[model samples]
Target: MDKDARDFINEYIASLPWLTIIESVNDTLVEDNYVGKIVIQSFKGDVEIMITIPQDFPLKGIQFMCIGITGYPHLMPNGLLCLNVAPAGNLAGELQEHFSKLRTWMMDYYESGKQDAHFEYYIFDADPKITFVFEEDGQKTRPAHCCGRFSYTSLRQQEISDERVWLVTGIGDTPSRFSATFMSFHQPTYEGLYFLLSRPPMINVNQGLTEYEDLLLLLTEEQKGYFFSTAASISIRSGYQTGCIVIVGYEIPSLQSGLQELRWEPFFISLQEYPLKRDPITDEIIVRPSSVSRIHWCKGINASYERMFGRGRLCSELTSSKILVMGVGAVGSQLAHSLVRGGCRYIDISDSDKIEPGNICRSAYTFVKTDIPKVQELFNQLVGISPHLEMQFNIAIEPILDSNKGYEKLKMYFSKYDFIFDCTTNKHLSIMLDGMQLPGRIINLSISNMARHMVVITGVSQIHVLKNRIYNKISPDKREPFYPETGCWSPTFEASNSDIAAPLHYVINELNYRLEKQLIIASFMIVREEMNHSLAYELTYDL
Candidate 1:
């Protein structure tokens, strides 16, 4: 402890007449790097207790541990009390709050237990090597079936946190090549076994499982026979490239979800080669396996659709729809980012320019300079956002618009998508798109000078109506002047990324709402930021 902390502790202890310090001793027994202990008299009676302070005292806070107490649900093996106290604030106030809570806990402990309604026992302990990712578990009647044998794929691998992370492609016989269409499905070479138990595999409810034999107690006689035979068969056939994985699942009820979900704990075990003997009476082959090698546990991560995207936040239409975004400039790049984060996976981006240093200040372009085209760089960025994202990029939109047979080629290309977002502020392009008989819907998105107004025009081609709406709604007096990219004069609008992103958030949410409700109509809308620091929305037309 520092001088300030020591002085504060001394002054605080002097003020409490009922509290008396017995001794000060150095100790480091707990997991939180405890530095020292202060044995003090109990606030109520003659009993004594120790208050252990971690190395980073005020930062990590302090924990109270009884000297020789037992049978307390909140106490750990080192006698440390598991007090769910908030982070430490002002030193004087935090010390006062902690002692006050400790006294209350002591008072309630003697009267009755203080266990919460949603407490559960730990089944098995493990030192995780890799994070196992799995699909989302939707609303089901029971947890995933814990059959004896299972299969997993190691094709998709990533290095995360200094370890190799593998995804759990499937749990049972049928495996899905989720989003990765290029991968072909075949019989997985790696396999493992699992066991399901109604009760925890423990010698006692409170004690931890230490040995391999204790696990067999939780299994039935029939399960034991199947487990031994499977282990023997796998040990004989399996090579030593990778050890086997055994999963133990327990049906634990949680009050938050009000469902009995399966709590899974996985471990890496070795079933290399076991000895076989013949039974005397039945003349049957019996396989006896060796003891469990390592009891370390591996981490399991749920990357299911429900958990990745907030539950029900991603709509079916948005997820399944193929979107084409044109002109990856300031507004268009931000819109592409918003679409991907909102769960639009399949997107095609088109841009004809290169990313310059100036674009980084007001656009999604990174600081790293590259000789590649903007669409290629943007495609690389979007693919890194999520493993499920599928995208392609091209520099053909501008060329197609300028050609003599532009409408024919553009219509043929645009028909492949469900929605085409036009963020290019080119009037000629919008006019041309509006006149063409296109198959997909055209939605024009743009921001005015100083990001004072944002316009969104949706449904069957309404470029003329959008222009009329903008002309009638925005006043000439409220217009702002244009600014140059550098000292040289190249006319461009003046607005930082934040200036545009603030209103674009509302636009994306509104678009999601429209898609969810299937309200794809010819509509013109404008978002205006008032001088009074308030926002207003104008719905000019909806047909």
Candidate 2:
């Protein structure tokens, strides 16, 4: 470091009471040597402390570890301070700034008599939709483990400190994949998405017990050590009344490596004042003394789409296929849900209309929005099911269908998807798209009166040819399939979701194979099903 910088640090040290400079190599920050060390006698004793110049001083921040006390109240096992919660940040401040924190921490630690500090317990993750049933007389059980690392306990009080710990149950350590902060829950009966998860009470969070008597057992000594540690938080629904114990507590840090060279391990603790509190001054946390709290900990199952269906080959492949869906009414919206369930992650939905009172029974959105665009509504609905799903949608199907409204350039944009589904049943728009040299495979899907029969036409410019083949006419009535529902121009197809969905699903299964390797194959799918059901009659033609 610069000589002036070192000189400033030394001058500051001389002013500190009970703190004396033992030695300073001026050249090495010591005279004679280009590299040297600085030793200081502190409150601990003559051998009180030493700040390691890990690299050139001022050029690199100083690192310090007492040659004495190790772990809690004193220092970590490696003798270093635990300020680096995740990892020690590069210390760049002047000597006074860094050393002052060390001094205050050491003095407080000494005054407190090295009492044990508490941390929060981090459960790997849990499910949202399913309710874990807890028996009045606990019996069934499983095995799990509490992972590594330590935490700082100096600042918070004995009873109300906001520390964190963790437990991973089920098969093992959650396969070590990158996990998100939280998991959302969904259920068929529930009409909306939610984030609340409830599970059974722990059978045993008792000390010296290797496993949690609840659903799973903790495997390691680190976990066992943590089992003995107490955890405290404001009780929401504990005791025999709620049956479900909500181990609510303060905020926990992201799980990562412990401070520098020491591992803190997990533990159980008791609670006094509420663990979570917002401070007004330094906004720092203040906790009252509370004993260690203990109860059995359990890991909930993760039921995400990727976790549930990623093992299948078709599901794996389809997730990577980019599907562009135009007109998300009854058919398109249902198709989007099916695709997401089949692990189709990349998708785009576009619709020119909004949901209306009459469209509720057939559309995908379970709830009603006053005048929200159809695409945005479907986009948010799909994301609620699978957080990993990547999709985008728009409300410009009308503009793209009109030549004067920039329809000619729209084909270039639509051509990027691997498969394009036109559920709009718009004959003019389908015919216009047929004339373009699209990069993606275009499949024009339409269901006739009451959904008694349906047709899916694939390949560029084949919409007319397939219709001719299916209807047996060179030019059939352009509006032969639709009839007025409410007004002259507004025609509605009476097919129910199952009536249209069954045939569309079968065709999609075939297209999954046909769309591979840039194949230019043209085909037609014709199907007629029962009024009460589907899959009655189906045929495919390759032309």
The candidate that wins on lDDT is 1
TM-score for candidate 1, residues paired by index? 0.70
Query: 242-265, model 1: which lDDT tens digit per residue?
Result: 466666666655333765555556
For candidate 2, write residues 452-537 as lDDT tens digits: 55567776675866765665532244555555354567666666666677777776666556545444556665557455663476
- What do the candidate models score in CA lDDT, each in turn? 0.63, 0.49
Error of 1 at 397 (Å): 4.7
Worst lDDT run of 10 residues, candidate 1, spans: 177-186
Model 2 is weakest, by summed lDDT over 10 consecutive residues, at: 188-197
